[model samples]
Target: MRLLLVEDDHMIGEAVQELLRAESHAVDWVPDGNQADAALLAQRYDLVLLDLGLPGRDGLQVLRALRARHDRTPVLITTARDAVAQRVQGLDAGADDYLLKPYDLDELLARIRALARRAGGHSDEAYACGEVWLNPVTRQATLRGQPVQLSGREWAVLLPLLARPGAVLSRAQLEDKLYGWGEEISSNAVEVYIHGLRKKLGADVITTVRGLGYMLACQPAP
Candidate 1:
């Protein structure tokens, strides 16, 4: 998934960004609320990791602005403010979840998975379409009851297509999910990954929508 991380502390930002990238997520990091707001305005993200104490506008103001604009992208507030009122304020201001500073990395990952599941409108930890199955946490995929090996980039490319089966995601959209800022993108990177996925998962697993792009093939009735 493509994620926007709003954080000012260099150490914390670096650590979290590294962790998320290791998990195959495309992440964009900004150090202040103004940059965060600008990033939000400029691109689409699957989720936003927001820090409450921000430099230009402060996190609450940023959250309020996002809601005022009616942007529904899920936001997870990560702040040092442990007060009850502050937590309530963050939630009421539009945060989907709150994590106090010094949070466990595992817990953070779990929360992210939960939020993603909710956003996708399903509660299953593993996403399945027809005979193919993928578990985000385990980073495991299987087809026809047999395990399939996939590279990191291949996993990243297949994830969104699996998450929303019928949605047609354009090449540009898939590229955004596969890479972050400053990362080099090959001209035919999406096509390469798609070919790899089709070869491994079966050509019929993903259908080309002519000029529209790609979508998971609808399963035939049993």
Candidate 2:
């Protein structure tokens, strides 16, 4: 998944971005509210990690503008403010979730997974396709009860396919899930990852749509 991180604190921003990347998410980090606002307007992201305290504009202000513009992208606010009133204000301003500063990293990741699941219209953390099972929260995959390891990029490509079993995802759509700002984009990167996923998950599990892109092949149960 691709995420936008709005944080001014250098230490916090670096740590959070590193963690998200390690989880195989494409993340774009901005240091201030203005840049964050611009990025939000310009790019497509699966989720937004927002900080309440920001320069040039407050996080609530950005949230208000986003809502006013009818941008429904989920926003999770990370702030030091712990007052009930502040939390209410953030939620009322369109923030989807709130995480106080000094929170545990595990909790933060858990919240992210929850939001992603909701956004994807999934009722649970795991996505299943026939005999294959994928746990988005743990970033784990299994085939016919056997565990399968996937590289970060490979997982990125597979998630979208698994989200909607037989639906085809355009190459551009899959590419968006794999690359973010400052990362090199290879023309054949999506194809390479698809190949790797097929090799690991079994060739019959993924299908090429010829001119369209790719889809997960629908298979019958034994």
Please report, as a residue range, the 10-residue window in candidate 1 with the lowest summed lDDT: 213-222
Please give, for residues 1-222, the per-residue lDDT of candidate 1 as tens digits: 999999999999999999998887899999999999999999989999999898998999989999999999999999999999999999999999999999999999999988998998877788888888888878889998899999888898888988888899999999998888888889999999999999999999999999989999955213
Off by over 4 Å in 2: 219-222
Candidate 2 lDDT, 6-124, residue by residue in tens: 99999999999999888888999998889999998899889999998999999999999999999999999999999999999999999999999988999999999999899888877
Error of 1 at 205 (Å): 1.4
lDDT of 2: 0.91
* RMSD in Å for all candidates: 1.6, 1.8
For each candidate in the order shown, give its overall lDDT on alpha carbons.
0.91, 0.91
The residue pairs that clash in candidate 1, if any, are none
- Listed per model in order, the count of residue pairs whose N, CA or C atoms clash below 3 Å is 0, 0
- Candidate 2 lowest-lDDT run of ten: 213-222
